[model samples]
Target chain A: MTKFNFELTKEIELLRLVTVGSVDDGKSTLIGRLLVDTKGAFEDQLMAVRKKKGTVKVSSAAEIDLAMLTDGLSAEREQGITIDVAYRYFATPKRKFIMADCPGHEQYTRNMVTGSSTANAAIILIDARHGVLAQTKRHTHILGLLGIPHLIVAVNKMDLVDHDQATYEKIREEMKEYCAKQGVRDLICIPMSALTGDMVSVRGDNMDWYKGDTLLETLESMSVLDDLDEKPFRMPVQLLNRPQTADLPDYRGFMGTIASGTVKVGDELVVKPSGKISTVKEIVTFDGNLQEAFAPQSITIILNDEIDISRGDMLMHVGQEDSDSKFLTANVCWIGDEPLETRKKYLIKHAASEVKAMVSEVNFKTDIHTLAQDEADELAMNEIGRVTFKLQQPLNYDKYADNRTTGSFIVIDSFTNNTVGAGMIV
Target chain B: MSEHKLTQLKALEAESIHIIREVVAEFRNPVMLYSVGKDSSVLVHLARKAFYPAPFPFSLLHVDTGYKFKEMYDFRDAFCEEIGADLIVRKNEDAINKGMNPKEFGVARCCQALKTTGLLDALEEGGYDAAFGGARRDEEHSRAKERVFSMRDEFGQWDPKNQRPELWNIYNGRIHDGESVRVFPISNWTEMDIWSYIREEKIEIVPLYFAKERPMIERGNMLIPYYEENKDQLLEGEVPKMIMSRFRTLGCSPCTGAVRSDATNMDEIVIEAAAARRSERETRIIDHGSNSMEDKKKEGYF
Candidate 1:
């Protein structure tokens, strides 16, 4: 057995992204091609796919059936479509990538929501000949609703359109107008053929009219390392640690993952939903005590005063407005097959807090294809609608558009406990 | 020892810790299925970090297949004592007394009884609503799209297709009376990630991973550990001998095979794994036939 050099050739920041597009738009093909071009797949992995039993290879040459590289399950292979959100990982010299490959079937749109929810950016693919379809609009709207910081429109299959610049430009203009209306601030449009391997990893000299960065370049250079530390401090306490002993009986600390901003030893703190005030005395990890902590860092913090805090309680800076509300309106994507109805009590899990909330009114549902709002009594599976909630207890949360951490929630069925719907505070 | 900016490693660690904490906070009764392997070691380490200066809210449960290496048991017992963790060892004493061994009962049936049923029996007694396992996606074909919060039915069955959509960091740990959810905090971590993390954290692992001279017998191309219990159960032409080998994955002793390597330390093992082309599961003897991990997991085998 030859020793494979598993060394990191270069230091690369990991970027998590999701690609959403309609069926046959070459999303999986492009992802496979990226791994192949970047040497992400091991030789054994490639060979295993090539020698897969009962699976046909699309190309005769040294090419692989790219779709087979990702649709791993036997059921998915038999059905010829992706069922769940399959996460694929690869790294380039510029950066490492965690790509969530979502299925494009309309019924599987719940999966798209699951995939795109935590993505730092998204690549919405488009068929060059088909132009801007309704599914494209639906995906674009979902990405915006997820508050994904960046967006890339990969206009795939230019080879089918004879690599024409006019068609690419037309789609670009249409997408720009549509995205502006959808509130996508950072958008990049790239036209390439995932099948021909042109401009995916290697910048093939095709369609010279497009002088912008390739999809790979755009993703690598995209500003995903946002200065979250500068934002107001917010950490939802998930666990409370108390080493209750004879010597250290009062040693109590609030443990949580810092969702945003930074904290120092002397900074004042505010426990949400209670407005109890305290000051940071120490930040603790298993390593040792710390003087300061920042977003995404898991730490146990000891405050100057003992505030009545428990699991699902959020701690934040006292003055961070736009991070609190009880009666809130939100855009909900009904993921469960069971239709959502007004006056239905569901468990709304927002950040670390879970509260029993009921939908007071089902405002209206959107026709994703026509971008029209229609009056509806309830939201079914894969349907998006606006609704108002009446919470049993007052909960402090940031708007979904402002802070992705506190602004989003999932509606769990009280009777079944299945996550029935995804909500983004409007 | 100090707060730092978000590196990729720190981010992954925080995410895993967050998941572990959520399970402990949300579930009515949660138990961690400790396998005493590298990934499980990382999970325990994360749990310790998640609740520092305080005792763990949950207990560690081990499903004893009665076929594991002697060194694995030693490591588990000592580690539990060292950490002062409440450890529960659930064994299928009925199946063992009924003469259910891999040599006689065959591989699949033996595993189903000893491993899957062992876990089921433990869960039944504990009434745990959630169980944490150190399963990773990069380890197998079926785990490519597995959710971090994987749901199990009343019969402890996993429906790969019909799973709840886990969005954001909010996990729906809410389950019915008999249903449970298997939480994989380190689901996204690859084998490479596991080894790298172990090296970074200086976590303790079992000595079975390091190659050493041990009594062994080759059966079905697997280097089985030649124990006193299996002295008379050798196949027709198979004889026990001392062989220098190591296990890539630790399972029931009869089912898991040893790989010929000289990685006596974490550094050497990391280098070998990186260069060894074949995935780690290649060393798993039980995974050879129709008994895949996915199917075993559906039957409640961690």
Candidate 2:
């Protein structure tokens, strides 16, 4: 279809997602095909893809090379793999989508973590012939650790298996059993071919045996995001906006995005680490003072009384229980070349605060393929292990499952200033 | 600025404002790159809103190419004056002394000598630890993978292959002494989103965006405005005609191209953009080379 009159409002829902799989699992092709068939691509973009040189052909149509879609995804061919998470956007009348095309190589686990942190759902592509490969299990484990709300197992290359129902069932049952063991609660499995455009953007007639919805239909129907107001109030102050302007001579507003839950006027909250109590006086913005503000919305908070607080301090509900901790045992995915050795100091960046931290012990490393826990003394590059950290000071945080934003932190090498690892508090 | 459920546009506005505040809080010497374009205008407005009642905490750096349209300079002057922002216009004095122009030295060398070198010179003189850029991912191909807080090395080289990873909304703004981070808060917004937000917010833009009758010449599918400053370049057979035209994107006057459109306002531009088949960079002369922007960016061209 050529361009026609299309005017849209910003009121539509947006679904943020991440796509992960092993190398050559047709992840790029799947996204490319999905966007192309749904008319998400512009004419010039399609032309550029078609004219792309030195493409490895994966399409039978012979006109456009689908794999070439990964070219500009990062344009950084680091050892022939994507180096960063490339965010792609597409919209339907039903909803808007923002997806991160995460790399699959083992060493780039940090890239995968970055993509999944903000995502509500994950599309894990699994080759039908190679059911539940080691990389597939690794990605699933990472997804589970990140507390992603929904998961979709795209059993690709159904055409290669002649769209066999029994084959799909076997793979689905195996994955379900594994996920159950890994504590993954929500999942949906579908069989399709990204190369042949089956059950991706449209339902193929050959896959009539599978009665489930198409991938797009599933995404459109699922409420992938959580209502932030239902949880406890948490907003780490990014900065203080004391415009101190002419209209209001004395004005002090704490600027931040509510990590979860809501804050209303006169709500009782405590400043973390400082432990000072205050009532929310106003929710300030450029337009006007808001009656209430919730998660993901950036606004300024004004308290009734002057409290001693700064950017690093967090504002949280007083009712949240027993959150102070000096020692953290978290699941960490090491992303640096330097091995994570015990007693080595690193900076823990949590929310807006940073603390001096050192690994106390390496409990065990999970062999992602076998789902076996093996004792390890240290974690090298691309290794995932349960590690204990002793912080120089107490940190107020919730379990990763409770709130994705407040429960996670990053490990920065103190000397190199490199992000070496990503940890989710257990 | 409407107070309601977080709409897409409102979300974008909040995100941009947050980034600006982060720059102010974290960096000692920070500056906003104001190119006198729509994106930079939106960026400066956000900066003002981000620090309401107080003046902008940091100064603004405009790497004046001197080849820019006259209207852009006027808009830059008035906008900065109205907002009371500290605006510093840095021009490459060496190139001006050497009499460098597109007609003499071609688009690449001229842009390099004027914009790239001029921006570096400004940063060196100002010692800015952080610079806020209005680059959107949907605007260019390679920018799709850029971090919200992208880092440039001590020599101002962008290592696209070996860069830091950005996770969640939490950006790593940490850097060394010589290193600097280029933060893009509106990285998620698309071209249509920009125009639509402009209409909703009633943002005042340059008059060159509106179609008007002006003396113009066609050069290889692009319409070039014939300025009085360049009257000497007209050939004996070349007679410029007054045509209705407007620019989808603005840049150096000689390199920027205008389109044949009757879109005279934000609403009309939005409507025209909905049906237009051309990419935004099609009119840019520097990008005519084989994907040259990415290569230039790696060498510290923003």
Candidate 3:
């Protein structure tokens, strides 16, 4: 190892990804391999894993069980399963990565959703011996519904099947067919063995028939920047800043993150639900006033005119205002252990706005195994279903496919105050 | 990277700022827990940026164990004064009066009384509904699974198995009267990110992070810095030595170990950290035991 070229390293971008797999699919092993190969895992972490005194013994050809690296909880280690989503960080010369290691059990689908929600790409692991299992279909369906643009089907454990290219191709084709059905825009299939150190970071000789980029190369070369700035500008007001001080006694700036698109100093802006229009006087930051700002940048916006705006009011480009609706149809992923009861009041938190809401109807639950919509009265844990929500107050939102920031919301249990469900507008 | 896109550091900054502002908007009473370490320094810097024209909306709370490095205290007071921040210092007076020392009660119990119980008491006394902690997910295994908006029960205990499902950036900040939330603004940030951000932003951290010739004594294979309170802790044959070293982390002087290094400047520190093979918490003796942090967190420790 040498001193990092700080100049070149600082310019590299970040890539957020999630790993999807069922139990025994070597998901954690794959992540551990990436971290170790990239020097992301520290010596201490590896030492801890090697010396871990757990009762359950993981079967692996490697000296240490890579799966133990991610199964952090005592219960998980004891049970030899991942219970929740765990985030791991690694960096290559090309890009920095935040990989969400999602749990792979059938019942932990909600945990997978939680991890997959923010990912720009997903790595769906399939054991070569078991082709595309029902668990794989379930994971693929959930990832697609979460709007993950890129999907990499990693045909793991090729060594288990004697490094057979036919086996790899079979799983690849099955995954491709399934992903296409789910409308996955970008898909790549790779053959590798996490245990043998093959095709994960480096190209090993085992998969000579494979001609695609290694898993690392695909992640590094993949385009993470989207057309978010090209969309209509939206900034959800998170806080109304009022600094009543001697220098600036009457300063009132709306503080928020740019949800989508770009805004300049003189750009015209409108507050949603209020229909009041104003111009951006200044895009303020601690460093200085930025002349222009785009999506995901947190800044304070001062309007040229004094408008009545408070927290939860969204600033948007005029004529691109979202629809104001009190009733909405959405695809909901039930996360709470307690089943969702229809007509019971819950809280809907949408883009800085929290309002009382209730499930008006459960249209149908998606049978993940077959990807079929089944009629349902209520949703149980890990069940994905279409539901109608009646809100106490109207929300300004867009279709989830068009704009993820404005279109998504979480269902919070009013009594428990726990985030019970995650919903995306249809 | 595209010209229009923000750099990784800038994106991280924006995300942290967004989290800070969101907590301020949602929580009625929120306080930033400042420990005067490098992470806390970055956090304070972000909070300033979150509410630039106005001072940060909330006061900073420091749970003083009364056994921290004197230099940390000096830097904390000076930094707060420089930023014009409203700083609140809390201590477990009952435990201190009972003379609960690490040497007598052990590190875990001592930490429980001084840091954990002190923090819970302060939150209750201040009526804080939310607290911003500078915990990064990459620091520890258990924290890697922690939510950005972590909910705490009435007893301040963390339920690892029953955490709320945190999806995307839509954090649920709602809680009952006795419950509170621990918001980690930089949950996605890694140790390298923290040091890189510090170098890029020129953030002021305690001088202890930079290598200097300091008096120390070796205990349990760790270079423990000598403080006035640690004089009685010295063994019969052991003696303090002046060594060229710096801390990878800062906690209680007796528990935090210093590594032999000549990296006195920010650039050297960053380069050294990048090349170092060990984890950041390796130097902290309190974290030596497996699942110790998990156990502590379950008992209301941050």
Q: Pick the candidate with the highest TM-score.
A: 3
iRMSD per prediction, in order: 2.9, 3.2, 1.4
Among residues 3 or more apart in sequence or in different chains, the pairs in candidate 1 whose N, CA or C atoms overlap within 3 Å are A3-B275, A4-B275, B67-B253
- Model 1 agreement with the true structure over A1-426: per-residue lDDT tens digits: 454343452244678899999988888888878877766665546665674454433232145767656755666677887778888777665566788888888888888898899899999989998999888888888887788888898999999999999999999999898878767899888889888777786678777777888777787888766767778888989878777888769999888999888899988888877788999999988989988888888899999886699988888877874445557789998988799999888889988888899889999998876667899989988788899999988788777876778788999988877888999987
lDDT of each: 0.82, 0.82, 0.88
Give the per-residue lDDT digits (tens) of candidate 3, residues B2-90: 65698899999999999998898888999999999999999999999999878898999999998899999999999999999999999
> What's the C-alpha lDDT at position A296 in model 3?
83
Quick one: how many clashes does candidate 1 have? 3
Comparing 2 with 3 on DockQ, the higher-scoring candidate is 3
Per-residue C-alpha lDDT of model 3 across residues A5-118, encoded as one tens digit per residue: 889966788998999987888887898888888888777677667744562342332646676666677756777778888999999878899999998887777778888999
Steric clash pairs (candidate 3): none
- Candidate 1 vs candidate 3: the lDDT winner is 3
Against the true structure, whose lDDT is highest? 3
Lowest lDDT 10-residue stretch of candidate 3 chain B: B284-293
Q: Report the CAPRI category for model 2.
A: medium
Error of 2 at A310 (Å): 1.2
Ranking by DockQ: 3, 1, 2
List clashing residue pairs in candidate 2: none
Give per-residue lDDT, candidate 3, residue A367: 88
Error of 1 at B256 (Å): 2.5
Q: Per-residue lDDT for A315-386 in model 2, tens only?
A: 987877437788998999888879999999999988878899999999999898777889988999878899
